[model samples]
Target: MQLLTTYMVRSQQKFATIFLISRGFTFQTMDFQGKYHIHCLMQLDLKFSLSFNSFTGNVPADLGSLRNLTKVTFSYNQLQTRPDGLSFVTDLTNCTKLQLLDFGHNKFKGEIPASIANFTNTLHILLLGSNQITGNIPPEIENLNGLQLLTIYNNSISGEIPYGIGKLRNLMDLSLWGNRISGPIPSSLGNATQLLKVQLQENHLEGNIPLSLGQCRQLLLLALSDNNLNDTIPKEVIGLSSLCIIFDVARNFLTGPLPLEVGNMSKIVDVDLSNNRLTGEIPTTLSQCLMLQYLDMAGNLFEGGIPPSLRTLNGLQYLNLSRNRLSGQIPIYFKNFTMLEMLDLSFNSLEGEVPQEGIFIDTKRISIIGNKELCGGIKELGLPACKVHNTKKRRKLPKLKVSITVTVLFFIMLTCLIVVVYWRRKSATRPSTALPTEERFLKVSYAELRQATDEFSPSNLIGQGSHSSVYRGILDGNQLVAVKVLNLRQKGALKSFLAECEALRNIRHRNLVNIITVCSSIDFTGAEFKALIYDLMQNGSLEQWLHSSENQSDMPKLTLIQRLDIAIDVAFALEYLHHHCQTSIIHGDLKPSNVLLDHDMVAHVCDFGLARFLCGSTNLDASQCQASSSGLKGTIGYIAPEYGLGSTSSLLGDMYSFGILLLETFTGITPTDVMFKDKWTLHQFVKAALLEGTKILDPSLLSSEHLAGINGGQSGDVDKVRLEEGVAAVLRIGVLCSEELPVERMDMVNALSELCAVREKFLRHGM
Candidate 1:
């Protein structure tokens, strides 16, 4: 190893070519002493990988001596461009067979040299992201016609994206977010028919979204948020059928009615057009989007009632129409939105009594705030009681009319008697709880999961939390799933497994983790193999976003809107479990790690290991609710203060945990962060920061310059004190919900209401 580092023994090992790669393990920086021992192996024509290492210092120009190199990956290292700058890139042009150049997540800086055009024609991917690289994308880059992916996001690259980028006819992915790039999207981009994902958000780009982009029929993800783009969204762009992943155009100056062509994107899973000037009624044609799951049209000028056709979307999970001019009664057919979890209709001119059916039964699941004319929901919403007027004027009825009325009443009585008798007999024979309520997507045996997860291999493991080790697996139907194998040996693990089954059996909500099936069969060893299966979340858990260091460079940090959405999602899930379900459930352990994000970043609350039934009523005491279970109710840092006094878990405890979660999400500091000592806590830290307007806010939230305009800087811009007020209001709710005294803490409905109020301000003024 020493000789390999120094090149002193290159004569003895002239055949050495490839370097060992480090992944999933940390390594200390080892000085290269400016050596290039691998140059002797130029005849071997081997690939070199020094990725995921801690190597530091500038790229040595001596590396150019390896003319036979075909792939060079120095990703996730501290390597940078030499002080002479980008000269190393000029040297790499000598490697005639080079096909891949990956220098992502490094300290590389300075302009990409025009000499990049000299790279071998075989080069297909240029991954130079997460660096300090600056300067315009040179038009010479178009020479790499064979390039498929070019990602330089999260860099200091600026100036208009070279129109030549569209000339890369074979390009499949183009990501240039988190830069200062300005100028309209090139119409020539339509020429790249193979493009799959295009993310140009968080830039200074202005002008209309080019209609030519619709020509890229293979596009799956199109994100153009946090830009200065203005004008009406073209109908051509809205009709793309292949945009099935996500279509986000939020935080722009878009105007005009939503195109009816939106219905053509039937396969898309998520759509966001919030914070725009769009007007006119929502297109009823949206009903044609059968696969839509998440829809957000908040912060727009849309008027008129929500189209009744929206009820036809059985798979829809989230819907937000808040902060709009939408007026009219809430649609009665909303009761048929069976899978809908969260609905926000706040800050609208909607009228009429709020419905008390389906998701509407939970005041926490629906928001009618700012609609003063709305009346009557569940008692918790505080809407006025609906009025009834009984004024009967009996006119002398004709003999024929009286005779018909009497006959109809006689038959109604006879039918009622028969139904009562039949129902009584049926009720005596079977219990209501015996009926299956939760939908099962599939049923698979333990053996199938074993095969799917390679006999429970360690490499298949995706998570190990809440007494269950979750493994990634693909079933026979090509369905991706997360198989959570229980650790029954742990204390309370068996009980938790049973509790989860009971809790999920009769409950279904879109924001809650959707369970596919459960396995209770014996393993190959004849011991029990208890496991729960769910849809595999592509983004993993919120904890991974908040703290995971393994892939921080690769994963995008959560934005303010994303954080708000996730917080709202968790609240909806909690509201459903606590107040909407047939039997109230207390998610005893509510924390960031338990919240999972699907592919579209929609949150799904998971991990029911500490979940339990709140049998009696909403006001049940902790001991009464936990009589059937034993052991601690929550994780150490998130456990309610009352729980430490030997009290059993309650819904209020879950609210407390949720409050902490909200605080952590914004501050990017967990309750157990080392900064808290003595009497200080996460609450105290935030409380102090709120007063001082200190920069305790997460840096990721401040990355976009536009936020300063939305968030109302300390100078107090009048167009948006509402934004600052909303921020303070969110922190206040966090404090109030997590108060030490349970009696003083707000209920889930009130907490939800406060959040909606804050969210309304954010949407209406802060965008």
Candidate 2:
């Protein structure tokens, strides 16, 4: 390590590209000392990138001594400052040739210094996300007329978005989510015709969305969910046909009818207008969006039956018209949506027989619970049967036909028994991700488990947590399994084990991590031992996909649609836990690492150590999500804001964690990222980005071949637009669900409805 450090110090002049990505190196930490940043470093046009490294300490000012430095990529590091408040950025102004500056995803504390404006006009892209920086963005930031991408997302930035930002004619992307910035959005941003993505959700921004945005002919994605923005949506803003990705403005006070001109966004993928005051009939012109996969208008005042033109959106995966005033028979054409997975029309005044075909075949996939007057075609719906009708054309059935049908039934019954037996046998295979929910309890000793994991060898260890260590093992029959051994020495390890046992005792779902058995015995040294054995997921955890390192070169990056599917699967598991179980269960911790993917890439929610059971028929909405606990539970960042105030665990808290998971999955940003510390949060960062129309996309989603598969077989540009829009749509769902206020947050039911809508198009295209 010392040798490498010395080599780096001596060869600073020769170092042009310091790309240190994906090594997953766990050696001792290395410090990039101030001595290495001297003027002798570069002779000409140097591009230094030390991303994804463990380098520590403050960024030295001497880095500016390199007059020829053009690009600096210092992301994903431990570099921090001591009350410096981003003063490191001040030194970089000396590099007049600098064009790109990225210090994102680091532990840098402090503000975006005023010197940011002093950088040469050649500077285009500036990234400072996921930091502990605080303060308002300087208005002089517009001095960099050549700026194209400016992202300061997930920080504690305050004050208004700069009014002078409109001066940058070449600007394309702007992301500034999760800040305390308040005031109206600058309408001058409309002049930046090159703008493509704008994300500014989760802030205190108010006033109407600007009509000038309509002038940005190249605009594709726009998100402004979870803020105080009021007034009706501008028709000029909503009518842009170039909006190929997402158009989100949910959780605002936007009043009045949804404009019929919304039909102009023909190439859009996801559109969310939920939790607003928008009224009037559902627009029939919405059928123009042949590529639409997700459409959410829930919590609005739209009245009428499901539009007939919507039948053309057969590619939809989710359609939510819940909490509305719509009244009429549920459309039968809904049965034609072969790709649809969730259809929620709950809390509406609709009355008619519910269709039993397509997505309605499974009661778990659809919700119509609050429509008391509706009758059902399926008995599981618990609705009254359709009224018996006597038609004038009643005819007698032939005896020969009845006899032939009876014969067929007899043959079918005989065939069903064989199929059932085969299914049971196949389901018993231990290597699969899913285990039989009901089985004879198996008795296993500590010695037997020790043998499966080679006597608990470190080499066999798969994962380690605060109170448990997981090891991969093989049973007597070559059955692969994961063994989570409890850490008895930890403070609450015993309680965690007990809680997990209680949570998993009576509930099971296909999307949930499956446990096989348990071992409570004594180890060789007479020490107490307890471990849980679960079916091993062949594809590993969702963390491996979203945050892949260089060691993961063999692992293909998950496409936007693929990530959407995984997120949907996790949401389904949580929905089953919080609402479908005999007794409501809350998985207190819901970060990406806890989500395991099977060989089929299906996500399974796991780690029930912090699970809570909400016993009773208490209504979650009325309860304000209060559940008693002795202390705070759940991982930081993902935990609900109320939990930090000694509020304990609740159904709402789980929803918050799920919301963070949704954001992380789509945007590839962790809930506890360095940028979301103190008063700043992941929800706000994403929200602000949506509101300000900034670019908050995870670049990994559009790199290499991932873009090609995002839009099915569409053009390259279309692929990018649709993929980004889909991501923004899912990110908005996350934003609403993870809002600071429990009441403002979308419940599990509504979130699932929106997610089901987001993943359909990709699934239909076989993504």
Give the per-residue lDDT of model 1 (tens digit) for 162-203: 887788889999999999999988888888878999999999
Candidate 1 segments exceeding 4 Å error:
1-40, 391-767
Error of 1 at 616 (Å): 73
Residue 263, candidate 2: alpha-carbon lDDT: 68
lDDT of each structure? 0.80, 0.80
Kindly report which residue stretches of model 2 are placed more than 4 angstroms away from their true locations once superposed. 1-44, 392-767
Q: By summed lDDT, which 10 consecutive residues of candidate 2 come out lowest? A: 1-10
Question: Candidate 2, residue 143: CA error in Å?
Answer: 0.7
RMSD of 2: 28.9
Candidate 1 whole-model C-alpha lDDT, 0 to 1: 0.80
